[model samples]
Target: MNQPNTPTRVRAVLADDERLMREQLRSRLTEVWPDLDIVAEAKNGLEAVELVREHRPDLVFLDIRMPGLTGVDAARQIAQLPEDDSWLVPEIVFITAYDQYAVEAFEQGVADYVLKPAERERLLVTVQRIKKRLAQRQDGASVPDVAEPAGAPLQQLLHKLSGQLNPGAKPNYLQWIQATVGQAIQMIPVEDVLFFISDEKYTRVQTARIEALIRKPIKELVDELDPSLFWQIHRSTLVNARAIDGITRDFRGRQMVGVKSLSEKLEVSRSYTHLFKGM
Candidate 1:
């Protein structure tokens, strides 16, 4: 007879600048999830990112406002991390002490939000929702490198919170990109660009007339550019929605995107295939 599979224990990382807040949150979590293993704790957002990268925990509870990198910034970095068999992205829960103005920005269902000095009733509800999501992921783990959908809602929520944190400051999306050509710097209007492909060091900007390179990475550009105008087709590539000519399938059944006035084709990463669903 075959042996039954063992249940995987959920692990988590807790990040809060205040020791007392971290302790209180940990205590409450223990009450709700007795079997949960909190593998690590961090005192700041930078530490939180490092811990998460090292532990690859099943969940993370991050205090929204931390010194240096804010929780939102850290979450952006975490979301951009490369996923593999050993490290599937963990579910994130934002812990905030802000008033209703800030709390209202969190989108329902993308992830849970907990107020400071968490009440048992509210925390339990969040716990139950997370449990259901974990159960679903467990069932789906049989697929090799399962492609999780882009967390667009979460990204938008984060963007809103960023403004809330800054109070008077508003986010301005990118309008122009400065790329260095052979001998001079050229300012390219965002709409005129065909697509952006990036490597570790530089991003190549392609336009109908000329191609140039910039030092910005795709991860940073995703936050600055208007999501509706430029869609992220792959981890390393972002294509202009207006410049897309058509999408075709390759022999391996991967979706390839073609740009207007450009022969180069961009492959849509599995995580971003939903962008082409309607087409």
Candidate 2:
């Protein structure tokens, strides 16, 4: 017996600070995708995140420059959100003004982007791409054309976009650390550090030859270090990517990262496991 497949009902959430921009995007989206259900709207990134958590929309259109928690930040948080039904993660489409550099960065990533003052032609292209991705998921097949490839994770793309928007935000990452070794403060070259494990009080900085203690926590270090160089495997641990020896699974089948020149393996928290998806 043959049965016709029902069309998938696509739901979406829109986030933008300007009312006019939101309306414009909504109207255009409706024109391009009349069947798309605009489940909710948000005025800022924070609100967008909350809306996503509530509605679990299939798509999210986020404005890059928001008051607090820029679109990139919101996307990072959304990516780490708990996934249950295998549908919690929605396809993200960034909304931004026309910036040559920003657009160039977007082209290198898997996610699509719409310029401010949305154009019908461009929106149509984005709509088509989104439809393809959603259809692939529904069919229980891999996204042949849009899957995250090497150097194209959402986090990496967000990092590039954030850098483009805030050029001087972090010109140079921490190159050296002042850590206490008994009575003396040692100048530990950041490259020498294998991993950082932080507790309530101090963070332990380990290297092949020596270990030291620093007051800076892993959170602060994450912001101060170049993300391309250091990968945050867990909330309390950040390991240098270049220093990674390999990856292995523990007894519980949890992913663990092995550091070069280090015997102890660091566990990758469930939230940050996407960073090692190659495994």
Pick the TM-score winner: 1
Looking at model 1, the pairs that clash are none
Per model, how many backbone clashes are there?
Answer: 0, 0
Cα lDDT of model 1 by residue, 29-110, tens digit: 8898787899999999999999999998888998889999998778777767676645556777888887652344333234
Off by over 4 Å in 1: 1-7, 99-109, 134-153, 180-185, 207-211, 231-234, 241-279
lDDT of 2 by residue, 33-88 (tens): 89899999999999999999999888999898888988877877776555563554
Give the lDDT of residue 186 in candidate 2: 94
TM-score of 2: 0.66
- Computed on alpha carbons, the lDDT of every model, listed in order, comes to 0.77, 0.77
